[model samples]
Target: MTPPMRLRRRVRFVFELARAVWWLTRIELGLRRNDLPALCAKLGIECDLRSAAPPATEYVVLPRRTRTTVLACAYAVARWPMGSTCLRRCLVLGRLLRSLEPVLRIGVRRDGELSVHSWLEIGGRTLDATSANYATLGSP
Candidate 1:
């Protein structure tokens, strides 16, 4: 790519990262003080906490470049002193990829002790690791 083009792309990426961080902060605060539905509403995502299946409405898949940027931002935030949890990451990702109709899933597993995990799914495919092992509790 040309030098100017590369610079422009980098600038856009940084902007997106900042936006993702802002949304993450909002989501974290919302989770601490409000209920799930309220948080979803604030983020402009229609979530059905009772539903397990992905939304029936069709959605266009997010472009690979955008998906990579979103995931990178999530990872960056997760490395902070106040690290992001699985639920938080999924919530943020769901909000970021709302146009793609991401499904936020919570699941549990019995591995000597019970453990809960959360992940996001798009087009019926799980977006992160560890979800395959957990029995789904529900999706939002």
Candidate 2:
């Protein structure tokens, strides 16, 4: 018999949480120290790491369930004791949406305080919870 919707959602939540934890652990242990390209290679994901070009204006609509799963994964990963960085968040999100060819982006802002941030974009449109102020670095 089919499970109830609430039970299905809960199961999805748990799966997403486990997926997030696995990716976060792999990234932290295997890929965190490498440069952008190397990290992408190790993860078998593509991204933009350059700082040229304006943000893409096109947006793609992901299924509600997929979006929900990605959000849950992000939340779970970020809640870790040390907390997650933008790179970790984006990587986990990208892994979930790998078929979508999400472009992982690292941007920098150097106003008074220089800072770098990583985010994911799909079909040229930036994903939710991404910063708009940071300048685009590159993609793959």
Candidate 3:
């Protein structure tokens, strides 16, 4: 068996990764682009008080995206809610995602009448919204 010290290190690494995942998941729940940099900075500080290096800097610089594509295609048979609220939620979640995965790009745009959307993507994979050529709106 590995030494206790090595085992402890392994466990700690796993724990930190898990913590990162949890924080990102929460962002995926609800957050705004402007609200993310500070929120993620706070989260990183709390999660790793021992480290002097800051983590939030990376998230603050990522780009943004806007999309109104459908969500949960597999659940199409289940008929899920695809309303403005859902798209808005994705936008909020995109903010959190910024901090979690620095590589994931983001953008925001508005559609017809009072409609705004945000989304995340990496290597052409749609993380939040569906694949639809929604009308190109504006950005922030």
Best by TM-score: 2
State the lDDT at 51 in candidate 3. 28
Better of 1 and 3 by TM-score: 1
Comparing 1 and 3 by lDDT, which wins? 1
Q: Please, what are the lDDT tens digits per residue for candidate 3 over residues 60-134?
A: 322432111112221221232333343333333433344444222223334555543334443334554432333
RMSD over all Cα atoms, model 3: 13.5
* Cα deviation of 106, candidate 3, in Å: 5.4
How would the candidate models be sorted by TM-score, starting from the highest?
2, 1, 3
My TM-score estimates for the predictions, one after another, are 0.78, 0.83, 0.28
Q: Where does the lowest 10-residue lDDT sum fall in candidate 2?
A: 51-60
Backbone clashes in model 1: 0
> lDDT for every model?
0.71, 0.74, 0.36
Candidate 1 root-mean-square deviation in Å: 4.2
The regions of model 3 sitting more than 4 angstroms off are 1-34, 40-111, 128-140
Q: What's every prediction's RMSD, in angstroms?
A: 4.2, 3.3, 13.5
Q: Which ranges in model 2 have alpha carbons more than 4 Å from their true place?
A: 1-3, 57-60, 128-130, 138-140
Worst 10 residues of 3 by lDDT: 66-75
The global Cα lDDT (0 to 1) of model 1 is 0.71
